[model samples]
Target: MYLQTTIIAIIMVATFALASWKLKSPEISMVITAIVGALVGGFGFPSRLLVEGMFTYFDVGMIFLTASIFINIYSETGAMNALVRWIVKQFYDRKWLMLVLLGILMIIPGALTGAGSVSIFVVGGLVASVMSYMGFSKRRVAAFIYLFAMLAAVSPPINLWAMLMAAQANMPYVGFNVVLLVPIVIIALFTIVYTGTSKTPERKSKEHILSELPLPPEGMNWFKIITPFAVLLVLILLSKFAAFSIPVLGLPLTFVICAFASAMMDRKRWDVRKWFDVMVKTMDQVFPLLATVISVGALVNIMTATGVRGLLAITFITLPMVFIYITALLFAPFAQGALSYGSAIILGTPIIFLFNSVGLNVTVTAAALSLLFPLGDCLPPSRIVGRLTVETVGYEGSYMSFLKAIAIPWLFMGAIGLLMLIFPNQLDFLVVY
Candidate 1:
């Protein structure tokens, strides 16, 4: 039974990979794979299992939905454009400084919201024009923006993947901050420097660059422009240290408050119909991801029900500890079909348990795994961020260009994962108690 079930699970996984690679629609692939797995395993369609799986991530789906709405309202206020214009004006003559700041700015929305897709549309879209003005190619700008956005999505305070991993391991989400900070800083610096050095043939033309930036609206209120993000950051930080819990999820709550504030501040310009339209479009864009989350839940349920996860764990137990460590690092990047959160919960939970059984620190192992999970965001088939980057930056070329541009950062992050694996003891300082 064990062997047969294991084979069935492997086939199911292979089907998912093939579908994701060939069909390029992880949501469809996962749903289809779940149904097929159920039949093959005599689980008989698994209606309850499918419903349970989808509902498991219902809160996360809410976060994405509300967060997208909030960002849409915020963007409609013209604040994002105003902020970009202000930054360009402040560092108009200092091209390198402007680029560095712009990269950092690109990271903020994702870091705050824990959604790279939101950040890509909110910030990545605006920075494309700025980077172009500074003489960087569209491909390079796209790669840079996408890399930072991914980093922010997984960064501390609100990183969806880290939050899910910590919950799965029964650890506090706050604990990940210490371990994640190092890699985040390292990657951010690398991005800043790389963007600073990238120059186009039009490098020397400050006048041309200035001419290209969109002018902030006449009578633009900087206070209104900064308020929404300010409210969001304060609420998130307070939730972490304050004694009280906010109603609903902290993330969605923060977004709601900010969205309301933004709408009030821009009352004159705000149109309910327009805002609703944008919200609908955002939902349309994010539906695939939301569906993939549900599919992941179903797939994980099927694996657990068939005892495949247990068999896989036992198989790993027989391997040398060192080999197991290396395997986890390598497998981390390809674990997620299309979404990082799904991959973290499904594949990451088991890997953490595997490492814990070997007497390794679960916290350190989980941190390392979490760091490596986002690399999958750049890999082929469902390369979520890669496709988003190309589209947002208006890159005319293939998705491969975005991947190639981000290769160095990807390898750098992978090396960190390997280090955490090989030197868990030395890196034990990163573990939260």
Candidate 2:
């Protein structure tokens, strides 16, 4: 049975590669892989499994979709523009402080939404403009956008990779706030500093840069800009702190409420027609990621039903500790490169179970593993985040050059993830759940 399952798995991999190569769509590639796996496993077109699998992460997809809508609405209010302009006007001359502030700014969208693409979409272009004003090259701007956005996706509140693995392993997705927050902040800041200092280009005058930034629409103010996020924070806190007293709105509804609140703040810009347009635009932005999520669920369902998941888990559990470490470092990004979020279920859950069997703190291990997955967002086949970052930053450089630009921070982030995995117990104190 093990041998048969392994063969099926290999065939699935080959099919995924071929589909990805031919279709160039990770979502479709994964669906094709799932169908082929089912056929090889003798399931012969299991319609129920296919449908059930596709909906496995339906809640997650909703969170992403609603969050995208929320962000689009927020951006439509000119909040994002006002915020970026405020940052530049306030600290553009204080280079280090400005870099740090910008890093934190980039982190917020993805941290809230658990989709790095949101960060790239909502704030990336604005931040890229700021980076260019500092005389950084387009390649550097792209690297900065990708790296911070990646870390943002790894941050607390909505780390999708960690959340998915935890759900798969029957672990609650709590206690990750501190576990994810500390390391992500440190790494994000370091990435910002490292990338910001590379060129040290002559700083453009504040007046010139400010003039170049988009003028925030009339009626924009700090109160209008800050109110929506404040509402989001309050809702999230209420859900966590007063769970029993309040109805459970979940992240999706919370985002929906916040979207309405944000739209209310800028009524002049947000009529019903405007809201519909933003919804359509957001759906267009989110379709690829939503499709990837659905396809990953289907593929994982097929793997589990066919014993392929069990075979992989047993194989991982039996590997030497050192080899497991190597796999965490090496296979993670490659898998993610090919599979996108599918890597979380395909590899991350098994590794978490393996670590749990060995007395490692599963929360810490899961959190650590989340750090490694986004690095693959820029790699081949999918290159989802990388492609978005390049386009958002208008990077016309060679793809290889862009990859080379981010090499240092990428390795640095990977090293941090490996350390967290190796010393999960030591990091256990960070878990507050």
Q: Residue-wise lDDT of candidate 1 within 1-433, one digit each (tens)?
A: 8779878878887887787778777777877778878888888989998888778767777777777778777777777778887787688678767877787777776765677776787878778777776678876787688778778787765677766766766766666777777877887787777767766775536566566656655556878887887888788667766737654346777778888998877788768687778778778867866876677777767777777766765676566777756676567777753544677876666667767776777666766776788878777567777778888888887666667877877777777777776676678787563
What's the residue-level lDDT of 216 in candidate 1? 56
**Regions more than 4 Å wrong, model 2:** none
**Location of the lowest summed lDDT over 10 successive residues in candidate 1:** 240-249
Candidate 2, residues 1-433, lDDT tens digits: the string is 7789889989988998899999998889888888999999999997999999989999999999998899889998888899889898788888888888888889888988898988988888888888888988886677789989998899888999999999999999989999888888778877877776777556689899999999889989999998998999999889889999999898999999999999899887667789789999999889988998999999999999999899988888888889978777789998899989989988999898888898889999999999999899999988989889888988888889889978888998999999999999998999997
Error of 2 at 192 (Å): 2.2
Which candidate gets the maximum lDDT versus the true structure? 2
Task: Evaluate all candidate structures by whole-model CA lDDT and list the values in order.
Answer: 0.73, 0.89
The number of residue pairs in model 2 that clash at the backbone is 0
Report residue 305 deviation for candidate 1 (angstroms). Answer: 1.5
Error of 1 at 242 (Å): 3.5
What would you estimate as the lDDT of candidate 2?
Answer: 0.89
